[model samples]
Target: MIRKRTLRHFIVFVSVSGPICIVLFHQTSTRSFLKDSCMCNCAMDSEGRSWFSQRYKPSANVTLNRKNGLLDFHTYWWWKSLQNESVVANYTQVVEVMFSLFPDKDHYTDSSPSRCRTCAVVGNSGNLVGSRYGALIDSQDFVIRMNEGPTKGFERDVGSKTTHRVIYPESAVDMGVTTHLVLLPFKILDLQWLISIFTTKHIDLTYMYVKPSIIADRNMVMILHPAFIKYVYDSWLQGHGEYPSTGFISVIFALHVCDEVSVFGFGPTKDGVWDHYFEDFKSDPNEGPHDGDFEGKVISQLHQKHRIMLYKGW
Candidate 1:
């Protein structure tokens, strides 16, 4: 009976002293751990916790300066000549308006002080076939994929390094989302797509809805607010070189949202190939309405600026 009583007392003592020992081990002579721990001033946050902090409350102070004079020529010209109608009335205009909003900086450096981990915006052409860049591309910090496409034999060409998928309600597909999903749309219909298509299973959805919008469903998906979008847009508009290429949009999405970014399938092919990926391959190319040469020139300039990388060779 006496030994049982002693054992119970010993158990109680150890439980109370275990925490006290830990507190002493981590505590400094001048500062008391008790006071600091209450305010989250304990030892460094674990790796997992640090990652969460970067995702939720990043230290970098991102601000969007979009005053009147700050607007660029295309932007000033477009907005000043604006009718009372919607600013982004068409797809072309939407692209234009989106390009106008860029981030303050482009490159995100890791250990290299000067060169950042540049993103190669590879446009889906048949050029990337047999390039053996699927695993290499996947090694990048972040990869962005867009539109509807298949990735079996053409994995090298399309790159399997898709860290994020930018989707609109209209183009939402059943392709599996392994990492993050970003919805780029303005109207309620797009939001509906975000809900119906991206179905909130285990995926994390972020809505970069621009102004003149609202969150229809409270529990649908986490939104990034128009202010953040405007911030990115303004930054891109003021950015150097060809302001807002398709790759530029991806970079802007990453600069504002992700820590580092790498692009794939975003440049002109060896020749001219624009048929949908699912469609059979072809030789003749479809240069967009804008002259291919002109667009290529702009893309080259963005590459030089390090804002984007053009995947030219195999």
Candidate 2:
């Protein structure tokens, strides 16, 4: 496992009131644009780039603080506060585990000035059942898929090329060694599970029997910053849902990473059914913690604003 001394500085503990708060040190330098007053638009201003872009965009250089680490103490304890001993222990364990697995540096960086970068954010909506969008999706410079959106059995509608996969322990799956495993940690336990699976093979429980270990490029493995996730929840969705879904987070992640972003397999199907293209069972939008309807509206708004291109394949 690759280790870096600077990884320890990624997260800093501060005393707030009486309890300890985990402050994401890197995000302190950046301004917060997700405040309620600035919810209207993400347009660029004369001052410089839009706050949304500046806040979420992937850094060109991988400095120690820029690497994936918990930055916000409030966000870290948003789901569960550190008042509980278990929570603090879990947070410490996760930090240690992450440090052990932290890459020497980022693998993907900004493309050269001469090239135009395009990315496809593919979901598993049943709308892609017969769209035959495989070739178009594969042609992009990057193809990002979320959860267990498969291509082996549904290549005609969904492309087979997967450059990056945004997932958590619950929705984890194995991928080619060349693909990047972008872990979207919802909580401290999620981060612990990710490191445990890869290093110790002790975590085998989730929604299903998760693979104790996965085969993927360690250098390319990326973890989404908790602050970034909070930004999407507060800025992009305006706190509409309990939390941003993995698919929604992936779209926002692509916005920062790719110059041109295209979305597919989101929203309801032709018959107004919520289902995955690779599965026959129907998905209930209300079943999960996410507000699917609100997310759909936000996605549509992004498309209208020209921030993203939504491909609602019939």
Candidate 3:
């Protein structure tokens, strides 16, 4: 099992308190776009740099207060984001209060130039019905599962081991003590929710009503840096989707922390349907804020560049 020291988060400024908008994935069926997804176009960016470049900062995480309580002002831009009604006044105070309970430590101390920590980022695409990828997935040094994707009976295809589970207030579940409950705090209220969940259990509303508490290891909880989310949105997807999907963000996250990453349950299914493994949809899957087509292209670029080995489940 991989042990975590400090897990800080995504830079979120406001709360999505109004509504949780569901953007049905708009499929891009153009041949040119499909080819782009297949080809290793490393020059997709204007700078003409490869996604596999060592220049990419793995420590996208911002350490607000260092060992001596010194602040990194340069990373302060992380708090800039799409504002909403529930804007926070003193960001530092709110952050420090949250850190008072959750320790502020860098999780990558286990990282080394000599070490190779492989990770398996499991998605919930329906194509994994019978691929039998369980053994391969569990064999990795880290197994990252996102949202509510289950591994109980489907272990034969999706694997049962989970080192981390990335979720938001609405998507949260009863996680095991061993697995890291990575929180996607898109707003200040989200952070408040994190603190409340473990202590007072006072928070029970966001864009939708949420569980005040969940089963998780307080020590192992991690937060996704909002800057990291912004980074993926701007750099990787080129501002395509309203924001990056948890699955896409998980892949980018793996690239930053893991030495060798093998992605499973990405892209469309064998039937070309964009859906999850646990649910049954009669027609096309409901759309979300993410641009499913653009995300696919970027993933294809990463796959072609040899940066990641994408396992499009059968």
Candidate 4:
């Protein structure tokens, strides 16, 4: 706990551009303050935590600026996503308007700096079965689950508490009133889709039919910056696979926000079968287009380095 310490401010880099600086309400500053802080698209105040990778630092702040300017156009991921004429034509205008509906900063990090936030990133791997991690997962300060992983029937394995759900349009489901619907926007239409959910239900199609609106609090909605997504792909993954999977993205997201992160149900089982804990086990081929083998190894490496705690249910 931070005792009666003098509150001091520091100049920190919150933008990927590296020029923008903001004064945050942190208690202390060090020579390594700027060096240790996450300088990605969003702002972070990791006073009590330490990270070893330069690919990106640990930051709970996900969104870069109030209005993120543009994704790195050089990457194929950026250029390819911009193909939609209507979506891309008014991308800037759309984002500015949509951001108005949500909180500018991720409220998770708004708590007192002395409090150590512990997080649980529960994956959908079949290994979660028989682990009895429900009680443990629910105890976390924040619990971030990904995709279509359901918790109603399997609360004994996967906890029922969900603070954030990382999902794209195709995998979206109506979450609890308090849970944040963290949208992983693959394209501009995804952004439009989210806006339509709040306003007009006109965007019924985004390569497939999507939920017109969900039973979520519009104030709790959050979107990841494309630049941060690209950073995880290019820097962390070293440009592996077509793009980063939602599972990996969620892990990275938790790392930024939580001082301690615990991951569950991530890799294949002992028999090497890949399936969700909720689904019947089958000798399913590794889920496409993600490089599952590589990602699993990366998760293990992060665990080995003590950056995160990986719980692989036997």
Per-residue lDDT tens digits for candidate 2, residues 4-73, read: 5455443332224224222433232121322111211223342323534543434422222234543556
Better of 3 and 4 by TM-score: 4
Worst 10 residues of 1 by lDDT: 33-42
lDDT computed for candidate 4: 0.73
lDDT of 1 at 59: 27
Candidate 2 vs candidate 3, TM-score winner: 3
What TM-score, over all chains together, does every model reach? 0.46, 0.74, 0.77, 0.78
Off by over 4 Å in 3: 1-51, 62-83, 87-89, 282-286
Q: Residue 11 lDDT in model 4? A: 20
Residue pairs clashing in model 4 are 41-64, 59-256, 60-256, 60-257
Across residues 1-314, which tens digit of lDDT does each residue of candidate 3 receive? 12322221211211242222222122222322322222111223433234444335554652222242332454334434443636564556767777787767766556543456788999988888788999999999899998899999899999999999989888998887999888876666777788899999998987689999999988887777766777677677777767778888888888767767789987667768777787884323226677878887878877666667889985
Residue-level lDDT of model 1, residues 77-175, one tens digit each, is 443332232322343333333324332222222322122333333455545655566776666666666545456666655666554555544444444
* Candidate 2: C-alpha lDDT: 0.70
Alpha-carbon local distance difference test for all models = 0.42, 0.70, 0.71, 0.73
Best by TM-score: 4
Rank order by lDDT, top first?
A: 4, 3, 2, 1
Question: How far is 129's C-alpha from truth in model 2 (Å)?
Answer: 1.0
* Model 2, runs deviating above 4 Å: 1-70, 79-93, 104-115, 206-209
